[model samples]
Target: MRDVIEGFLTFQQEIYPNRLELFKKLAEAQSPKALFISCSDSRVVLEMLTQQGPGDLFVIRNAGNIVPPYGPEPGGVTATVEYAVAALHVTDIVVMGHSNCGAMKAIAAGQPLDNMPAVSHWLRYSDSAKAVNEAREYGSADEKLNALVHDNVYAQIANLKTHPTVALALDQGQLDLHGWVYDIEAGVIDALDGPSRTFVPLAENTKVSALSTKLG
Candidate 1:
């Protein structure tokens, strides 16, 4: 807590003044270009990773970076998706999962979440990702965990489409969807390639953005 306060103090003294103009503009309104949904991992800093400034992204974070299928359940994820699409008019939605995600590892190992019932229940949204891992034959736990991380991103992107706002925007070609996996150790990002249907170095892929537009 002391460290957090020190960080805030530093931000207030050094960072805030440097970006004062940006902050003032943001205070009025935000018109972000992308909606970034990623896991609630301290290591995964979306703003730093994307090199995006104050109003560049509208973000949503949660355990396992999961987005439940649209239905009766009331959740912040559902509301954020709807607002980003219908109200904010964000053009792109990026669902990103990181390597060695704790949530994915726990489920892959069948670790008991008996003490954390809420966490266990929330992770049910990622059951599809677990099923995908089960169908594959992996040689190691790490491999299986990585597969779940990637699969979960895809699963959430599908879930995003289930929302009426997302569905309508997609139908009208006003929105694009992306699936990404960030390698923590390597500090690299792998994006889903539409043509090859495989994860590839994001820098090597020029077709991803264009492909997303077409998929809309």
Candidate 2:
């Protein structure tokens, strides 16, 4: 706790001064480039990893990085997506999963969430991901975990499309969707290559092969 306070002090006294002009501009309004959805793991710092600062990415972080299908059940994730697209007009939506994700591991192993009813219910959104990983052949636990992490990104992207705002933007060729898996140990990211149905490095000239990309 003290460390966090000190870090904030450093940012306010040193870092903020250097970026005061940028902060002044951001204070008036924000027009972020993309909607970044990722797991709420302490290890995954979205800004640090993407080399982005404030006003660059609108973010949503949850236990599994889950996005429940757009429907009667309203949630913060759904609302955020709508506003980011319809109002903020973010051009891209990135659903990211990471290495050794606890939620994915639990789902892959069929670990009982009996003690955590709410968690179990929430994770149902990623049930399809578990099914995909289980149906495939993996030689070891790590491989299975990796597959689950990647599969969840796909599942959530499908869910994102269920939003009317996302659907319309995609149909009009105004939006792009991305699925990514981050390797914590290696500090590398693998982005989904939609056309090839594979994960490839996220870099310049690289494109995501997902519904939004296909439609856009």
Candidate 3:
């Protein structure tokens, strides 16, 4: 807590003054271009990874980077998605998963979560990912884990589409969806190529439209 307080104080003393003008502009309102959904892992810093400043990307984060399918009892994730789409009109939504995800490890190992009921319940969102792994053969545990990470991103993208606002935006061609897997060890990001249906390194030359298809 002390560390966080000091950090904020440092920001106020140093960073904020330098960026005061930008902050003033942002204070009025925001028009973020993307809705970035990612894992709640401490290591997955979306803004830092994307080099985006405040007001650039609207982000939603949860354990496992999960987006629960839309239903009558709308949760925070659903509400945020609706707002980003209907109100903010974000042009893109990026669902990012990372290597060595604790949530994926928990799902794969089936670790007893008797003491962590909430975590166990929240992870149920990855059921489709688990099923995908169970039905396929992987060369090794690492490969399987990597596959699970990718599959989870894809799964969440599908779940995102179930939202009415997302559905409408997609139909009108006003929005785009993306799935990405970031390798922590390698410090590289693989953007899922929807047409080729494979992960590729993010490069300036990479055509985003080629990777916009719904992930399997």
lDDT of each structure? 0.87, 0.89, 0.86
Q: How many backbone clashes does candidate 3 have?
A: 0
- Residue pairs with backbone overlap in model 3: none
- lDDT score for residue 214 of model 2: 72
TM-score of each prediction = 0.94, 0.94, 0.93
Of 1 and 2, the candidate ahead on TM-score is 2
Where in model 2 is the C-alpha error above 4 Å?
none
Clashing pairs for model 2 are 194-209
Position 83, candidate 1: lDDT: 93
Compare candidates 1 and 3 on TM-score and give the better one: 1
Point out the worst 10-residue segment of candidate 2 by lDDT: 204-213
- The segments of candidate 1 whose C-alpha lies over 4 angstroms from its true place after superposition are 209-216
In TM-score terms, which candidate is top? 2
Better of 2 and 3 by TM-score: 2
Q: Report the lDDT of model 1 for residue 94.
A: 89
Q: How many clashing pairs per prediction, in order?
A: 0, 1, 0
**Global Cα lDDT for candidate 1:** 0.87
Over 1-216, each residue of candidate 3 has an lDDT whose tens digit, in order, gives 999999999999999999999999999999998998999999999889889999999999888999998886445999999999999999889999999999998887778999999889888888988998879998888788888998898888878879899998888888888888889889998887777777778874255532355332
- The list of candidate 3 runs beyond 4 A from truth reads 209-216
* Displacement of the residue 210 alpha carbon in candidate 1, Å: 10
The local lDDT score (0 to 100) that residue 62 gets in candidate 1 is 93
